[model samples]
Target: MLDASGYTVISGPVGSYLAERLAAAIASRNRWNGCVWLRRPQRNLRSLDAALAEACAKRWRADTHPTDDPRRRLERALLGSPEGAVVVVEVTDLTTAIGRLMTGLRPLASDRGVRLVVVAEGLRLPVVRFAPDALVAPAALGGVDGLAARVGLLASAPVAARRLTRLAERRPAVATDLLDAAAVWPHDVLLGALAGRTRTLERVTAALLDLCTPAQRSALETCATTGYWHPQLDTGVVRAADLRPWLVPLEESWSWVRPIWLAPLRRALARRGPSPVVARPAAAGPGSPDDRRLRPPDDRRSRSTGDQGSRSSEDQGSRWTGRGVVEVRLFGGFEVRVDGVVVDFPGRRGRSVLRFLLTRPDRRCPRDQLLEEFWPDVDGRAARNRLQVAVSGLRSALRSATNDHVIEYASGEYRIAPAVRVRTDVEEFEEALGAARSAGRPDVALSAYHQAIDLYRGDFAADVPYESWTLLPRESLRLRYLDALDAAGRIALRTGRIDDCVVTAHRVLEVDPCREDAHRLLMRCYARQGRPHQARRQYELCRRLLAATLSVEPAPETTALYRSIRPR
Candidate 1:
C-alpha cells in the first residue's frame, strides 16, 4: 500500500483566517508525525502565527534559518524529515517566491517524503509552479456572501454566525468599518458598543464622501432616511450617467452606496437634506444578486398556485406561460402538468431519472449516481452517453409543458431548477407531515396530517408498482402515509373529535388493513361513543386482516384493547 504522495497545495484567497483553518485541519490528521509553518518575518506574519496557535492549539516555533545564505536555510526547512511530516509555507508574493522555493524544494516536493502546502492570497498566486495534481483550490470569497462565511469560520456562537450571514447577505459589496468589525470579535461584534470616535470609522466615512459626488452623497442621505435606495425611483439619479459609480446595484431596483459607510453617510446627510446624484468619472462595477436570491430553493417556489390537496382536484386554467409552473403528482399515480397542461413521460428510463431528481430537486445529481442506480450493468462511457440522450428525450417530452426549465445539465450533472415553480405532491405531503411533527398545537398537527393524507392520491410511483426499482420508494411512501394517518387519528382522539378519529383510523386501515394500531384506534373511537357493537366489529375486522394477510393472531396489546372496548 502507498504511504503518501507529493505534497498537496491548498489555494484560496489570501487571508490568515483561511490559512489558520487549513492548518487546524492538517494538524488533526493522524498520519503526520510532524508539522512546520514557514513564512517571512513581519507584523502580519506574526498575526498569522498567533491565529494558528488559537486555531490548531499548537504553537509553532519561528525557525527561520539564520545561516549565511537564506536559500540554504529555506532548502533545509523544505527538506523536513525523510520519514513523514507536513509543511505549510505562506507566500506574500507568488511570482518571485513560488518558483524559487519550488526550485529549492524540487527534491523534497518530488520525493513524497514530506507533504508541502502553500497558502497565499488569490491575487499573489498568478501562476503556480507546483504540479497540477497537488492543487486544492476553493473559490475566492466574494463580497457579503464571502464575508458572512468568513465570520462563521471564525465565530463559535450560532447566533453570531447567523447575524454575520444576515449582514453579509443584506449588504453585498457594501464594505464598512462596522462590517470589518464583525471579523474583529467573530462572536456577535454587531452586538458590541461603539463608544468614542474610532479612527477606522472616521477613515471609512472620509473614504465614502471622497468616493461619491455631492449629489450622490445627498441621494445616499435620502436613502438612509427612507431605509432603502431605489436608483430608478430617484428621478435625478436615473438621468445621471454616474449612478453606477455612485451606488452599486444590489438587486433589480435596489442599489447601495459603494463601500457601505452607511452609518457615517447617514449622519453626514442628516446635517442638511437630499442631494442629487451626479456622474462620476470612474466606471461602474458589476451588479450582484439581491439578498433575496439567497433564499432556499423551496422558498423560491412561487406560491401563486399554492397548496394542492391529496386526491383533491382543481381546474387549473390551461395557459402555457413560459413561467413553467410544473406540478408533479407522484402519489397514487404519476402526473406532470406544465403550467396547467398534462405532459407525458413517454419512456420508463426518462420517468425513473425524473423521479430521482424530483425527490431531491434543490441540488444537482451527478451522472455517476444516476448511472449506478439505473444502468448498473453499463460501463461509465456508455452510461454517460445514455444519460445525455435520456436528458434530450426528457426535454422533448416536456417541451410543451415545462419548456426550457425541465432538465438542465451543467458540469456533468443534471438538476431540475426552481426557476420553474415545481410542486410535487409527495414533497408537499412530506412537508405538511413534517410541519405537523413540529407544530405546537394539536389542531395544527391534525390539519397538517389530514392534508398530507388527502394529497396522497395513490402510492408513490403507483404506475410502476411491480418494477423492482420502484419497490423501496413505493413502500416508503405507503409506510409514511400510514404513520401520518395514525398520528392524525391520535390527535383527533386527544382533541375529543371521536368521529374524526374513527375516520382517520379507517383511512389508515384502507392503506394497511393489517395495522393493529389503526384497528385498536378505531375500536377506541367506537367504544368512546358507547357503540359496543361497532367496537366488536372493528376487533373482528382486525382478526380477519391479521389471519388473511400475515397468518398471525392479534398481539397481546390488541387482544387486551378489544377486551377493554368490547361490551365491557
Candidate 2:
C-alpha cells in the first residue's frame, strides 16, 4: 500500500479510521521482518530506541541481550533478520527527537536490506523536516462511490449510501460512523430522512466537533452560520482546519467537508451563545511581571466539584490581588506569580533554577547538585559561582514582585519558602484526580475527574522540553491525566453521554494504543448504541494491538464482551 523503501509520512486526520485501514493493509502484505508502531513516542531518543529494540526482540524471539545499548541491540536484530526483510515504523506522536532517531537508524536499516517506512500525521515541523520521499494525505475516501463501498453501504442500502457519502464528506471515519448509526435503522426505512433527524445527526456531529480544537470549532461554526468564512479570519485559521482533513476549501471560503455538519453546528452555537474572545497570554520576557494570576492559594476549598463551593467568575480570573498567596503555573508553560502578579526571571538560568527547585519533592536542592544539574559543563568552582548568581537573580526577581521571601537558602540548600502559600496547576490536577477517585458519589467523581483532565493543559515544564530531569515528572503528570480521562470516560459511558465517552476512549487510545480497557470502553459504548458491527470492530482493534505489541491475545473479559456483542 506504500513504498517498500524510504519514508512515507501519512498525514491522516486525527480520530479517524485512516491509521487502522493502513495498518490492516500493511498486515495483509505479511512480508516484514518486524513492524514497530509507536502510538506515542516517549520523551527521549533512548526510550524510543529501547522500544524499537524491544519490538525487534519480541518479533525474532532472539537473544538481543537487554543489557546491550538500544542502538546496538537493534543493529544486531536487523542484521540477523532475513535479507530483503521490510521494517516499518508507524509513529502517531512524532517529536523532533523521534524524527532524528529515524534519520540515524535509516542507514543501518538500509544496509541490512530492511526497508523503513515512517508514518506520521500533521504538517508539524518534525514531519516537514523528516522530508519523506512521499507525503500521503489519507483524508479523502476517494469520493462518494469509494466511501459508499468501503462502508458497505453501496449495494446494501443505496439511498443511505448516497446521503451518508455526502454526510461523510469523503472522510472515512465519518463514513464508518454514519454506517453504524444507519445500521440501527430497519432495512425498509434505510432510505428514510437521516439529515432531518436531529437526534442522529446531532450525535454524529457532536462526535466530529469534539475532534476539533476550540479555535477550529469557532471558525467552522462561523462558516456554517454566516454562509461564508469570517472575513476577519486569516489563512492560518482556514489552514488550521484544513490540516484536520474534515474541512475543504469552497470558493474563497472554507466549508465543512461534510455538509451535514451545518445544522448541528448551528444548534451547538445556539446553546453556546456568543463565543467569547479571549486574549492570548503575552509571552513572558526577562524580568517581566505577569499581570494576572491563576487562582488564590488558600481558595483550595472552592473546588469546581460543586456549584455552591465553586469559584465565581472573578475568583477564577486574577481576582485576589493581595500579598498572601503565590501561584505557579507549570502545565503548558512555566510561570510564577506573587500576590497575583507575574514574576519575571532575571535570565534563563534563573528561571531554570526556580523550576528545578519547584519540581523537587521537598522543593529544595543541595547547592552542589544544582550546580551539577544546571551548569554541568562549567568547572566546579565556576559552576558554584554561576549557581549562586542564578539563585540570587531568582530571589531578586521574586522579591521585586512581593515582600514575601518565596525562595530560601539554608544548610547548603535552596528551597521554596515553607511560609509561602504556593499553588500550582500540577498540584491542583493531582488533587482533583484524587478527589475523583475517592468521591462518594458518581456525579462528584465525574465532575472532579473532568476537572482534573481539564487542568492538564499540556505536559509538565513544556518550555524546557529537552531537559533530562523534566522527563520523569512530565511522563508522571501525563499518565495521571490519562488516568483521569479514563475515569471520566467510564462515568460518561454509564451516564449515557455517548459522545463524551467515545471522545475520551479515542483520546486514551491515541496516547496509549495498548490500553485494552479503553478499547473495551469504546466497544461497550458502540454496543449500547446498537452499533454491533462497530463494537466488534473495536474488539478486533484491541486484539490487533495486543497481539502486535505484547504478543498476547485479548483478555478473557474482552473476548467475552466481544462474544456477547457479536451477531449470533
Residue 503 of model 1: what lDDT?
Answer: 59
Model 1 regions lying over 4 Å from their true place: 1-322, 361-363, 378-385, 402-405, 566-568
Residue-by-residue lDDT tens digits, candidate 2, 204-294: 4555555445555555544553333322232222332332333333333333233444566667655654332222232233111111111
**Model 2 lDDT, residue 490, Cα:** 86
Q: Candidate 1: lDDT of 418? A: 52
Worst 10 contiguous positions by lDDT, candidate 1: 289-298
Residue 140, candidate 2: how far off, in angstroms?
A: 20
Which candidate should be chosen as best, given TM-score against the real structure?
2
Each model's number of backbone clashes? 7, 1
**Model 1, range 407-471, lDDT digits (tens) per residue?**
88888778987576777877778888898899998866776775576566667887777757678
